[model samples]
Target: MTLSELIAQFRTLAFDKVEPYLFDDDSVIGWLNEAVKEACIRGQLLHECDDVDICQIAIKAGQVKYPTHPQLYEITHASLELTSINGGKRTPVCLVSFEEMDKADRDWRDDQDKHRLDPYFLIQHDTYVRLSRPTDEIGVLHLEVYRLPHKMSNDDDVPEIHLAHHEHLIDWALHKAFGVPDSEVFDLNKSEMAEQRFTNYFGFRPDSDLRRITRHDVPHTVKPFWV
Candidate 1:
């Protein structure tokens, strides 16, 4: 649904009279933005895999600042290559803690030839990835990063989550919108119900394997250990 539609739906749920809107546009937009951010963080709905450049010139000794996408929230997978060849096959780099990366750097400094094959990364300042060593050559780095779902800015904008999950967004917005009391009573029950509904939908069966698995896929008997 569009941002306007979501706002309208939220108003319907939170207000008795729609002819005279109780909430301003900015107020509704704020609630919607919060809802989208919460949903994106809680669920794995927005993700993208793209090639990024770790510029050779950007390298200082054995580290290069890994560029970040605007909407990036987390990096799921990353691969590095020394050549510009797009499909030559790339090896995945292991993400390690700062201590591990420091060790790798020390090892490289001691004997570059001995640890030349090891490539590791540490997130620096929560913005850039600091490589243990600079690239042997210059090329693009491929990354699979989870992104923050886009905020609804325009009325035409649709959410990044699947359409089936869109209702949860409205539920979250309504919960926040009605959290403050408009009358003597706080209306805590309604707000809590909306919050619960959004949580239920957001975390619904997150770990279940969606792939079709049948009995044929299971082993009927155990085989010998050696075999």
Candidate 2:
């Protein structure tokens, strides 16, 4: 839903549509943005909510530096392919860790010929990829990265989450909005209910399965404690 729609819905749910809105537009928008971030973090592990982008890194001969996206939160995979010298076919290059890359640099300094073929990389400063050996031939590096959710500023901007999960955002926004002291709508029960609903619907814990057991599932002797 649009930000305007979300605000309207939140107002309706909070009963704040008298004359002067208990929560202003900026406050609601801020709450909604917070809600989006919360939902994004909560659902980050779910593949259904992930967005895939194919980024191309241009390789220049004797250049080992390449910049990464500012919004990049995590890199799932990185693949490097070298273009054949004679325009034949692209060959895949092996990816190595920081330690391996450092070792490769040391080995190359000692004996360049032996380690020239081994191209390794490590993320530098969490912002750029540093390759161990300078590229002998031009190639492209493909990176599959997961980025943080985009914050909504305009009314028409849509959230990155699935439409089915949008209501959770509203619940979170309402929870936050009602918690504000100036709003004059301080209901701990409502706030807690919204939070619990969001967690029950989207939050997944390691012990969720064990926690799902009902009282009826317990033995007669253990029922009293569970109840």
Candidate 3:
């Protein structure tokens, strides 16, 4: 549904269909943005692989880290791309938790091997990617990731997510509408119910589902270097 359509749905479902609506267009759109973001983050709806700015990261020699996509919700897979006669050569880079690295080798941080290429990436603070070691050469990491929603503007705007999930957006907006504090539309019971429906369809927001998706990427205790 378009922004206007979704707003109308929110009004109808929220029982503010008459004149002087309890929820304004701008307000409902704000709730929509939040809802879509939650849907994308939790359901991994807006997965991207070919978007250059989002799926590609340039690397400079000696740099061990790089800023990830601004709207990156989570990284699913990462591969290193190096200059090659065939244009570019891509190699899989393992993803691991710091604790796993610590368990395998306490001296993991001491490697500081300037001669080594980035072999792994650690998700740091949800904004920057920490490399296993400093880069020996310039390259890029091709990534597959789920991204936050694009902000919708006026009524003409549309959501980036697929049309299949459009009607579902209304549930979240209704949840927000019913939860409006100090507002005429506020209803705690309805708010909870709406939220429950949204969650039931989209599932809860993921904390770190990437780990489960890439469990094999974790280094083994006996063969830590193989990763």
Q: For this target, which candidate reaches the highest lDDT against the unseen true structure? A: 3
The all-Cα superposition gives candidate 2 an RMSD in Å to the true structure of: 10.9
Q: Which residue segments of model 2 deviate by more than 4 Å?
A: 45-54, 63-65, 84-115, 119-125, 181-193, 204-227
Provide the TM-score for each candidate, comma-separated: 0.70, 0.64, 0.85
- Consecutive 10-residue window with the lowest summed lDDT within model 2: 209-218
Per-model C-alpha lDDT, please?
0.62, 0.64, 0.78
| lDDT for residue 177 in candidate 2, whole number 0-100 | 72
Considering only N, C-alpha and C atoms within 3 Å, which residue pairs clash in candidate 3?
none
Model 3 misplacement above 4 A: 84-88, 116-125, 208-227
Ten residues in sequence with the least summed lDDT for candidate 1: 208-217
- Give each prediction's root-mean-square deviation over alpha carbons: 8.2, 10.9, 4.9
Candidate 3's displacement at residue 137, Å, is 1.9
Q: What is candidate 2's CA lDDT for residue 110?
A: 36
